[model samples]
Target chain A: MLAVQTIADGLVLGGLYALAAVGFSLIFGVLGVVNLSHGAIVMMGAYLTWFVWHTTGLDPLLAIPPVMLVLFAFGYVYQRGLIQLAVDRSSLLASMLVTFGVALMLRNLLVLVFSPDFKSITPGYAFNYLRLGEVTIDLVRISALAASLALLGALAWVLNRTRIGRVIRATAQQELAARLCGVNARHVYGMTFGVSAAFAGASGAILGIVLPFAPPDEANWTLNAFVVVVLGGVGSPSGALLGGLVLGLISTATSQLIGPAFPNAMMFLILVLMLMVRPAGLLGNAFAASR
Target chain B: MLAEALARHRWWIALTLLGIAAAAVVPFVLMPFHVRVGQMILLSTGLGLAWTLLGGFAGYWSFGHTAFIGLGAFAAGLFEVNALGTEFMRTDPLLGFALGLLAGMAACAVAAALVAWPILRLRGIYFAVAMLGVAQVLSELTNSIEAFQGSLGLVLPRIPAFGLRTEAVFYYLLLIAAVIILAIAFLVKNARIGQGLAAMREDEDTARMLGVPTERYKITMFVLSAALTGALGVIYAHSLGYITTGSVYRTDFSLNMIVYNLLGGIGTLVGPLIGAAIMVLLTQVVLGSFLNLHMFLTGAMLVALVVAAPKGIMGGLAGTWQSWRRRRTAAP
Candidate 1:
């Protein structure tokens, strides 16, 4: 029963990780560029939702769509204007540096405006819990899990079924080939970044409801998302879902079994071991195998 | 032509050496507080060199270098803290310093190997993100462990009355470390390994095909970098007489190192040192004034540097010099 409770709790946490990782994976898959600013966007979305909820008495869930739209536009413009210039550069280091500069700018901006204090969004029912058999779960956690699952399902469907999804996958597989086949790789890349941003925005809204956050919290999320994405597979959507679950279970189990401190070290150790043994991640095809 | 160029630059080299000599002697002549600041500048220069090895040369940007520094400081602190209160465990201060350096390097090597294995497979932005994750994970681990003193942090006991508390001693120590690091950098830049590193940075696949053992070079450079960084951390801890996760393991330090390299001129031998000096001086000016305004000014400076000259101040000056030479040769 204790084990069951831990697993259940782990699964709930995994949902959030999955949401973050999927957005990260989507951008990497479609654009072949890691969005370093994804975490900041996630933080911004959370703050936006929190502010709306605090000032206007709007439901945080209802604020998600508007936030997503705004962030999507922001991502689109960012890629079209700034990132497009670096698209032709063989070394992606320039883009990474640019994004890092942007992140620093955003962080300092946040510090100037919001200060360094931690803030959390607390609705009336934030801590409300529901008990099922011997397992007790927070209502907010359950809702967040459900919402994340729904988003993942919808994303998977869009990737598999939609016309834009086909173009995105094609672009990911071979950019020149896709271009020769009359696909506008640039447009797809921009749209794909937009979608990834929207996913991140939604995740942020969920995170705002569930966790205490400050400006630096974005860096934490970005780091964890990178781990999750790598653990799952760089460009695999389903891999992200499984990776999050595995990471969540490992972290929770390690905390329960050993001490809380051991989990992070253990997680990194596992990641390292996995990389040495299998560089393509657990589910990912080997580099040679993919070729 | 190369020898002639070197001959022409002899005066500049002489001037630089003289500057170093002057800097070395200033702590004895200046106030104690200024000496302390000089010591900090020298320490930061060591860190900047460590960063230069990997980021500046190999093009493998690591934002988690603070982990090594923090580990070094903690190891040294652990020796001083006497957590177990054992007399035999107590060693000479110099031995403690050496142990701290080794332990810090070993920790960084182990952590780097573990983290870099998976992340190294990634390119560009993904790689940077992975490094950030590594830092966060290590910091979180540090925070969660009680033996590490968790958030309260481990405090080092004061050194026995050795009469080495004078700022001049610290200045000399720091200057020696700085020289050693610079010598290493000079040797590395002129060696075959440097050529291989340059090739790797220019293009990895081509470098590998051309018989450069990219992975081995990266790991070796990273380890060396971490070891030097750790040694500097030990020195810093001893000078400050306190160690904390917040101070030792800071992203700000990592970012500042990158900025220093960039502002000085990445890939150049003397860039990081010059960059460190400039940044430290700028920081002093900023911090001397109002807090908010200082940050705003620094931010503005960073923006201007990035926009106006991404190659760095040194690179821009070199370009100008080269253009003037070209025009002079072309005329008449």
Candidate 2:
């Protein structure tokens, strides 16, 4: 019964992790640039949702769409304005450094605005719980998990079926060829960043209900996304889902078996070991065939 | 051959000696705060040079060089506190310190060696992130494990030497460390191994095909750099007179080391020194009053630096001079 409960909890957490990581994975896959400030974007989403809920007394889950829209615009402008400039001016690694700098700036801004304290959203159903057989789960967690899966499903569908998605993938495989084929590679890149940021923001909203968060949590989220990408493979929603599930399971198992303090150590240990054993990840890069 | 090599770089050697002489008198002439700043500049320069051995010269940019820093500090701290005991440390504190420093360096070397084989196989970003994971794991271990006492923190013994003030003593020690690091960096840059490393940086597979012993050179440099960084960390821990995991395993220290190299000129001996000096002065003196804005300003500076001068100060100057020379020749 305890094991079953642990597994259920892991699945819920996994859903959140997948949602959090998908944007970073997509950016890495399509743009070939590790967006180091990804966590800040996620945090921005959470904070925005919180702001909306705080001001209007609206439900947190219902605020996700507006928060995501704001983030999409922010991500689009950020990519086109700053990231594009960095990529043009310097090497990819140097561009990564630019993102690092931006991350620090954004984090500092967050601290100034939000004050480094942990904030969480508590709705009307905050204390409700569901009991199925011998297992019990919170209503907020179940909804958070459901929301995460729905978002991931939506992302997967758009990428698989949409015209813009195909253009982004083509640009990722061959930027020049895509340009030759009448695709504005830069615009597509911006759109991909926008989509990524929207998803990140949605996850952040869900995360706000599940876990308390502060400005500094941005670093952990970024690192978590990197680990997810490394574990699940790069560039696809399915890969992120797989990686997130495994990571969530591992984290839950570590805390259950050893102690809560050991999960981060275990996560990083697994990260290094995974990189050494299979640099391509379990599923491998989605666009590896194109390369 | 040694004498010939020395004669060839006579002017460079003289300038270095002159700089050292000037630096030596800094504690005597400056305020205590300035002397502390000098100590920081020296420490940063040493760390930057150590990082350059691998990151700049070998093209293996590590995002977690602070692993060695934290590891060295804790290793020495544990040994000094537990193994040597307070009685021995109190009796002959200098010898205890020397032994602790050696132990710290040894720990770092061993740790680097353990990870080098699996890690060195990774290229580019993989290598960087793997190093980051290493640092993160080590710090987490230090924090979680009660034996390490990282959460509790450890206090270091005060080094009583030459009847000098604490800041002055550390300043001299850091100066010595920086000079030693600079000397090692200069020697390595001119050596045969340096040539091999240059080729490896250009193209690792091709360098290996050309019989450059790339693997051996990389491991050697990694161990050497880790050991040197460990030594600096020990001295820094002593200067602090206390240390926690947070103090030694700072991500900012790792980032600053890279920034210094990038700001001055990557893969150059003098670049880190110049970069460290500029950054220390900028942060400590110019922007010191704006405590909360430090991160924002540093980030802004980094973004501006990358966009405007990607090749750094030395590279930009060299480029300008080269263009001028080309124009002079082309006019005729």
Candidate 3:
């Protein structure tokens, strides 16, 4: 019974992790830029959702669209204004530094605005729970998990079916070739960043109901996203889902078998080990593997 | 070859020694607060140089060099506190410190060597992130493990200062550490290994194809860098007189090392020194009042620095000097 409960909980957590990481993986797969500020953006989304819920008494789930839209715009401008400049001036590595700098600045901003206190969304259903056999689960987590899966599914459809998706894919595989085919590479990159931020923000909104979050939690989110990408591979929603599920399982198992405090240590240990053993991840780079 | 390189940079060498001599008088003239600032500069310089051994020379930008710093501090702390016993530490504080420093360096060296084989296989950003994972794992373990006492924190013995004030003593200690680190970097930069590292950094596969022993050079540099960083970390822990996992295993310290190297000049001996001096002055002296805005300003400066002068202050100056020299010769 405990094992079943743990698995259920792990799957729910995994759903959230996948949703959080999919955007980061997409950006890495498409632009090859590790946006360290990704966590800050996620935090921004959470705070925005929390603010909306706090002030207007709107459902946290309903706030996702607005939060994501805001983040998407912010992401696009950030990519075009600063990250693009850094990459053009120096190398990809220096661009990493730029993102890191922005991450710090954004974190500072979040702290100033949000006061570094943990914030969570508690809807009327927050106290509600359902029991199936010996396993008990909260309504908030179930809703969060449902929302995460729905968003991830939506992202997968957009990437596979949309005209813009094909263009983005083309640019990822061959930027010059895409440009020759009249694809605006820069615009594609910016759009990809925007889409990534939108998804990340949506995840933040979902996560707000599941976990309490503060400014410093940004680092953990970023690392968690990185670990997810590494585990599942990069650039696709399915890959992120697979990675997140695996990570969620490992995390829960570690906490259950070892201790609660050891999960982070175990996660990082596995991150290094996974990198050493299989750098391409389980699914491999979805877009670039063919190349 | 070493002699030839020394002869080529004799004037620069003289300037460094002269600068050191001038710095020796800083403790006497400056306030304790300023001396502490000096201590920070020296520590940063030493750490930056240590990082440069692998990062600048071998082009493996570790995002978690603080792994060594934290490990070294804890290793020394544990050794001094638990292993050596309080009575032994009390009787011979200096000797205990020396032994603790040795233990710290040894621990870092061993840890680096163990991880080097697998971790070094990763390249660029992957390598950077993997090192971060390493640091995160270590810090988590230190905090969680009851024996490490990282969460509880450890108090270090106060060393005999030879009649000097505590701040001055630490300042001088860090100064010597920085100088030693600089000397090692300088020697490595001029050595045959340095040339091989340069080649490896440019193109590892090509360097390996040319029989440069890239793997050996990388592992050697990694171990050396970790050990040196560990040595500096031990002194830093002593200066603090107490340490938690948070204090020594700071992410900002890791970032600052890279920032210092970036702000000065990557792959240059004098770059980290200049960068450290400028940053320490800016943060500690200039913007000291605005503690809350520190991260914001540092981030802004980093962004501006990357966009405006990607090659860094030294690299920009070198470019100007090159053009000026070219123009002078062209006139003739």
Candidate 4:
């Protein structure tokens, strides 16, 4: 029963991780550029949700679509104007730096506008929980988990079946080849980045439920997302799901067993060990082959 | 010809010497607060160069170098606490300095080895994130540990005579270290290993195929970079007369170092130094007045520079010069 409870908790957290990691992995897969600004986008989404909830008394979950739309447009414009310039450059390091600069600007902008206050959207049912035999589960966590899995499934289906998805995957594999094959590679890349931003926006809405939202604290989320993506395998969505679960479980389990301080260390240690043993990651080779 | 060349370079060297000489005499000219700021610039320059070894030369961008800097600072602080044998003891400052530097380097090397194992395998942004994780974990561990003073941080034994005690001496010491590091950067830029690093930067697989031993070079450069940064940490701790997790493990320092390197020009020997000087001066002039607006302006500047002049200030100047020369040559 205790083990079941832990698993339940892990799965809930894992769901959030999955949402974060998948968006990160998708950006990497489609563009071959790590969107370092993804976490900041998530933070922005969270802030937007919080603002709507506070002002209009709307449920945070209900605020997702509007937030997603805003971020999607931002991502589209950013990529077209900025990221495309670096696509041909040998080092994506510059892109990462640029995004980091953007992130710093965004974070400071938020701080200036909102101040460094922690905010959360606590719906009327925020504290509600369901009893399952001997274990209890939070309704919010369960919903977040379900939504995450459903989103992941939808994304997987889209990538496998949809024309746009095909174009994105093709571009990921070979940009020039995709271009030669009559695919508007630039449009696909921009759309893919927008979709990635939407995923992050959705994740942000969910994260506001799980944790309090702090504007400058997006750096933590960004770092954690990076670890999850790397651990899962860079460009694999399913791998991201598994990686997030594994990380969430490891972090949760380690925190429970040893103490809170050791979980981060253990997670980093695991990452180091994994990289030493498998540079391509457990699920990365297949995607690497595709690329 | 050698004499002529030496004579020509002499003016440049003299100007540098004169600058340092003026800096050394700054304690008498400026307020103590300004002197402290000067000390910070000298210390940060060492750190900026330390970051350049990997980020600029090897093209491995580490976003968590604060772990090394912090570790170095704490190790030095610990040594100071024990060696002085008094809460306020300032005796045998030289011994404290030696121990602090050695411990800083040793700790950084070990931390680098630990961090490098997982992070080095990942490329680009993944590597940067992994480093941040390492730094956060270390900071948490440091915060939880009791002997390291936990979250409250460790206080160094204050030396007698505030002005004459250590800050000025540490300033000169840091300045000397910076010059040595600059010389080392020049040597590394021209050496076989430097060539290997450049090749790897150009194309990793091709460099490996050409027998560059990419991993060895990466780790070596990472360790060397950490060592220099650690030394800076020791100097920083001694100059400040206190050590805390907040001061030591600052992410802003890491960010500033990266900004400095990029703002000056990447993959250039003098770039980090130039970047550090410009940034430090900017901060001193601008941030000192408008603290809140500083970050906003810096971020905007970084974005603008990346878009407008990706090669940075130095690179932009060189590009303009080359274009002018090409046009002049074509006039014939």
Show model 2 residue runs off by greater than 4 Å: A286-291, B1-5
When 2 and 3 are scored with lDDT, the better candidate is 3
- Per-residue lDDT tens digits for candidate 2, residues B1-332, read 44666789899899999999999999999999999999999999999999999999999989889999999999999999999989999999999999899999999999999999988877777677678778877888898899999999999876667788989999999999889989898888888888899999999989999999988999999999999999999999999989999899987787788889889988988889888999989998989998897777777878888888898887788889999999999997
- Residue B1, candidate 3: C-alpha displacement in angstroms: 1.5
Task: For each candidate in the order shown, give its overall lDDT on alpha carbons.
Answer: 0.74, 0.89, 0.91, 0.78
| Clash pairs (backbone) in predicted model 3 | none
Model 2 residue A219 CA deviation in Å: 2.0
lDDT of 1 by residue, B1-332 (tens): 44554476688668768978898779658888788778777877878888889888888787667777777777667755553332433545555455555665666666666555566765545456556667777677667776776478776544333565556676777788888887787667667898899998889889999999998888788778877887777777666766667778776676777777888888886787778788777777546665554434454555455655678878988999999999999999
> Cα deviation in Å at residue B200, candidate 2?
1.0
Q: Provide the lowest-lDDT 10-residue window in model 3 chain A.
A: A282-291
Tens-digit per-residue lDDT, A1-291, candidate 3: 989999999999999999999999999999999878888888889999999999999999999999999999988988888889999999999999888888888888989988978889999999999999989999999999999999999999989999998999899989999999999999999999999999989988988899999987887788899999989998999999999999999899889999987888788878878776776789865423210
**Model 1 global lDDT (CA atoms, 0 to 1):** 0.74
User: What is the RMSD, in Å, between candidate 3 and the native fold over all Cα?
Assistant: 1.8
**Stretches of candidate 4 above 4 Å error?**
A86-90, A286-291, B1-15, B31-37, B82-84, B159-170, B190-192, B203-215, B241-243
Q: Could you give candidate 4's per-residue lDDT for residues A1-291 as a string of tens digits?
A: 877888888888887888877877888877877777788888888888888888999988888889889988988888888887754442476777777777777888888877888987788888999999988998888888887888788888888899888888899889899999999988888898888888888889888887888876677677667668767886667888988898888878887878877877887788767666665667755334221
TM-scores for chain A, candidates in order?
Answer: 0.93, 0.97, 0.97, 0.94
lDDT per residue for candidate 2 within A88-191, as digits (tens), equals 99888888888878888888899999898999998889999999999999999999999999999999988989998789889988999999999999999999
Q: Encode model 1's per-residue lDDT on A1-291: one tens digit a residue.
A: 999899988888788888877877777666666666678888888888888998998888888899889988988887876666554532356555556656666666766777778888888788799999999999988888998888888888888899988888899889999999999988887888888888888888988888888987777667667668767886666888888888888878988988766766777777656655666776875323210
- The local distance difference test score of model 3 is 0.91
Q: Which CAPRI category fits model 2?
A: medium
Separate DockQ for every predicted complex? 0.28, 0.56, 0.61, 0.48
